[model samples]
Target chain A: MDNRPIGVFDSGLGGLTVLKEIIKVLPNENIVYFGDTARVPYGPRSKEAIIKYTFQAINFLMSKNVKAIVIACNTATARSLKEAQSKYNIPIIGVIEAGARTAAYSTKNKIVGVIGTEGTISSKSYNVEIEKLDKDIKIVSKACPLFVPITEEGWANTEVAYLTAKEYLKELLDQGIDSLVLGCTHYPILKRTIGKVVGEEIKLVNPAKETAKDLYDILGKQDILRTVNKDNPIYEYYVSDIPEKFASIGQQFLKRDMDDVKKIEIQKY
Target chain B: MDNRPIGVFDSGLGGLTVLKEIIKVLPNENIVYFGDTARVPYGPRSKEAIIKYTFQAINFLMSKNVKAIVIACNTATARSLKEAQSKYNIPIIGVIEAGARTAAYSTKNKIVGVIGTEGTISSKSYNVEIEKLDKDIKIVSKACPLFVPITEEGWANTEVAYLTAKEYLKELLDQGIDSLVLGCTHYPILKRTIGKVVGEEIKLVNPAKETAKDLYDILGKQDILRTVNKDNPIYEYYVSDIPEKFASIGQQFLKRDMDDVKKIEIQKY
Candidate 1:
């Protein structure tokens, strides 16, 4: 079994949600997470810049000798995953394919709705992945750009969240999608509100969960699973900018106190 | 009179509102507007980074031979204005001082409310400027971080805007502010909804208008006012990245079609 830590990185603290899932699925794995807080909200950035940033993140995690890398951000995944997989030696996983696979398998009516940042929705990666699996699956995708900010504001259970979800999901609901994917990493926190608006009939696919499962499956197959430690797993956190807010808002997202967060100059990579 | 264009730059498209006002104030002057669309929303960035970005923008504008510069963004003004002015020879003015001056002039009750991004509010630039003019005046500052995204989404007139303004302005209204400064450039676009919430008694101090007035005064005093052209004065736009959405949303912010838009690599500056 591999003793090396797994690497996870996102544009910002939204990636913490994915880390939470990894902790649940692989309790013994030491994980190193990097948040690119300095140049975050990778949604509006150009594909070249996103690719550059993703490589920077991966390289930084590699410097720490990670066994595997998980691109926790959907925008980064949709934009940079294929190129990254080809370039990197280690098994690199992105949230898009795993979520798409889960949604495709879970859907009973052959209809799926996807909601994410402008960058992720524009890339149509989910559509491409789903289409690869099942050509007949009808895809209804909506770009909910404001959802990230609203979720970060800690308004997940508030009227703001409800109204926003209602407004964004109305069109998708009308299309009679049987399953919907929470495409953005920040989305799972708002699942209750989204689920309430979409109702219980529609299955909600959280990408973080599927992504963790995918990582676990890969690690097991490759014989890179970490031995279970008697003590707590050591999770090192690195950020491209200040980490105080990361600790505060991130703790809310992860529902755990952040430990050993340090700032790194990402551009140096 | 100088025939050169006036340089106006913001961290993003919010500066276009200032450009729109400058057009109204100095119809004869040519204008060069740069939106650092690639590394935008400078509110959460460090002071050194903000100053570097401002200088990068200034250097780019100077290369185009702008006679003067307007720091149209509140956060940039708060963090980089003095440092930029000291380094550059041109007459550079920031929106904060002018907005404070206007708020000082307009407020009868000596209580003013200021709304802007977290960076702007945290810097207390408006409070410092206003206090310099009138020490006795009470300042109620609130950071409405979500407003910019909402404004960019074209939800300025919707129920969402109304509710957001209502929620944000409640404390300021309770503090009995006679005038409110729209401290962020994006805030002016939501003035109607903000006005409706704050009511008829409170005067809305729009920094863009005051900044335009400040620029006009500087140009006139420096004897560098642009001469009237036979045709319309040319306006050039530059961004660090793609200008597709810039043409559309920027037009909405500028209230006119944009012309001569170009993409530049800002880091080179």
Candidate 2:
């Protein structure tokens, strides 16, 4: 069984949501997370720039000798997942495929809604993946570009955030989809508010949880589950920007003190 | 008189607001602007990272043989202005000082309100600058971090934007301030909504316009104003990420076509 840490990276602290789920599922496994806070909000960037930044983040994770890599950022998954798989020999997992598969299996009406960054919606990666699994599945996707910034600004519970969610999700709800995928990693933090707005009938598919399940299954199949002591598994966090701010906001997702988060220059990778 | 173009740069298209004011004040001078769209939103990054990025942007503008540099970003000005001025040989002007000077001069009640990103507020640069000019002035600052994303998402005119602006501005209004500074470059796009919330009783200071005026005075004193072009001065734009998005959003600021914008890599600098 492999004992190496699983590498997780996103444009910012949103990846901590995925990391939290992964830790819950595999308590014994070590984790190395990198948040590219210095160059975050990859949603509005071009495909070429996303690819370049994602590659650098991946390379930095690889330097830490991770056994597998998890692309926690939806924009990176939509734009550069295939390139990542081809570039690295280690097992690579992205949220888009896992989320799409779960939505395909869980939806009863073959209708789904996806909300993500501009790049993710514009790429139509989830649409293509869901369609590949079931040809009849209809997907409605909207670019909720403000969600990431809202979460970063710590306005998740504020009335302004609720109002913004209503404005951004009104069209998606009007489509009458049975299931909605929280396509971007930062979206789960707003799950309670979004769920309330979208109503209880609409199933909110948290891709971070599904991705953790997918990773658990993959590790099980490969017989690579760590046999180390669960209580003492080491966890490391790295960011390319302000460590203090990361430590502060990251506590919401990690549910623990981030006193040890270290800042590193990822561009050198 | 020196005939070289004046260089202006931001983390993204927000700097176009400053560029627009510069054009209005100095119609005969050529202008060159760079927007680091790929790595925009320097507001949340570390001070060191912001300084590094600003230095790189300055180096890029210097490569273009710019006569002077205008840091059109408030966060950058708050975090990196001193470092930038010390590092670069050319005269560098940031929006913070220009804004603080204007706010100091405009406030009659000595209660001046400032709105910007979290990093800008946390730095306390504007407060320090204003207090230095006149210690009796009371500074009330609020961090409106969502304004950038709201503007970026094209929600500047919707009812949702007005609601968001009201929520963010409520506390500042309660302080009974006579003058307010749009501290972030992106805030200018939301000026109407902000003004509506603050009402006509409070004077809103546009730092970009003040900075442009300062630039005019500096150019006049130095005898570096371009005198060759009276009718048709050239303006060029460059971005580190999406050229198309920059061009489109830039149109809102410059009130002209973005045909002259070119995408270029600035990471090397």
Candidate 3:
């Protein structure tokens, strides 16, 4: 089994949701997470800019000799995943496919709902992926562009957040979807409010969790699982900006003190 | 008169608010705006990073032979305005002093409220500037981080926006501020809701307008005001990321269709 750390990167701290699940499932494996905090909310960026930034993040992660790469950003996955896979020899996975698969499997009446950033929803990547698995599945997609900013502002439980969620999710709920996918990484933080709005009857699938499960199965099959000491696996976190804020917000996702997260200027790379 | 274009720049379209005011005050003068949309929301970035970026933006504007430059962003002004003024020979102005001056002049009870991004509020630049002008003036500052994203999402008038305005302004209102400075350039677009919540008794100072007035006065003093406009004064806009989205949101700030904004890779600069 490989002992090399698995690399995970996102536009910002939202990727910590994916990292949390990865650590929970693969307790012994080392993780190297890069959150592009300086140039976050990649949601509204053009495809060319997203691809260019994603490449920089990937190249940085590769420099660390990661065994596999996980693109924890939905915008990057939708816009640049294939190009990244073609450029790198190491195993590269994106949250979109894992999320699409989970939603496809969980839907009872072939109806699925997806909420993400404007760019992600506009690309219709999730719809195409889900339809590839089951053409009959009806996809209801909404662009909740403000969710990323709301999560970044640490407004997950505030009354304002609940009201914002209600406004963004109202149309999707009216569509009567049985299962919903938190298409953007930032979305998992708002799971409670979103679930309350969508109600208990609708299944809420967190793409981060599904992506973590996919990582587990893939690493298992590839014989790349780190078989090291279980008690204290090293967890390293890197961000493009404000390490102090990242450390605080990261604790919410990791459910542990973030003493190890460091800030690095990724633009210089 | 020098007859050179005035340069204005921000991390994104927020700077357009300043540009719009400048155009209104000096219609005959040419204008150039640069938006670092690719690496926007400089609010969360380090002081050093903000300085570096502000320098680059200034240099770019200087390259256009601009008569003067305006740091149209609150975070940039808070972190890098002094360095920028010292580094460049051209007369440079920032929103902080203009906004602080207006707040000091407009406040009846000598209690001035300010709202902006986390970095802007944390820096307490407005408080410092206002206090420097009048120590007797009491200052109340809150970080309304969600406003930037809400403004970006074109949710200025939605019910969610009204609720967000109410939640963010409640504490500031409780302080019994007589005047509030739209500390961030993006805040002007939310003036209606912010005014509604704080009530008409509280004077809302548009910093961009005050900054524009300051700019006009500075240029007039320097003999740089354009005397002749043989043709329609053209406006050129440049953004580092998605041109389409920037153009759309920029329209709201400039109050005109932005058919001329071009996307450029500013990281290389």
Please tell me which predicted candidate would have the highest DockQ against the true structure. Answer: 2
Q: Rank the candidates by lDDT, best first.
A: 1, 2, 3
Candidate 1 lDDT tens digits, B214-247: 8999999999998667767888999997744678
Error of 2 at B200 (Å): 3.7
Instruction: Give the alpha carbon lDDT tens digit for every residue of A1-269 in model 1.
Output: 68899999999999999999999999999999999998887877778989999999999999999999999998888889998999999999998889999999999999999998877887899999999999999999998877887877787887877887898899999999999999999999999999899989999999899999999999999999987686667889999987335787998998888866899999999
- Model 3 C-alpha lDDT per residue in residues A1-269, reported as the tens digit of each score: 68799999999888888888888888898889998987776766668988999989988898888999999988889899999999999889999999999999999988899988777888999999999999999999988767876786678887777888888878877888999999888788888988877789999989889888898898999998887675577788888877446777788866787787678878766
Write model 3 residue lDDT over B120-145, tens digit each, in one string: 88788999999998999999988877
Docking category of candidate 3 = acceptable
Candidate order by decreasing DockQ: 2, 1, 3
Q: Return the lDDT, model 2, position B155.
A: 79
Compared with the true structure, all predictions reach lDDT values of: 0.90, 0.86, 0.86
Lowest lDDT 10-mer window, candidate 1 chain B? B241-250
What residue pairs clash in candidate 1, if any at all?
Answer: none
Q: Candidate 2, after superposition: displacement of residue B230 in Å?
A: 5.9
Worst 10 residues of 2 chain B by lDDT: B241-250
Separate clash counts for every candidate = 0, 0, 0
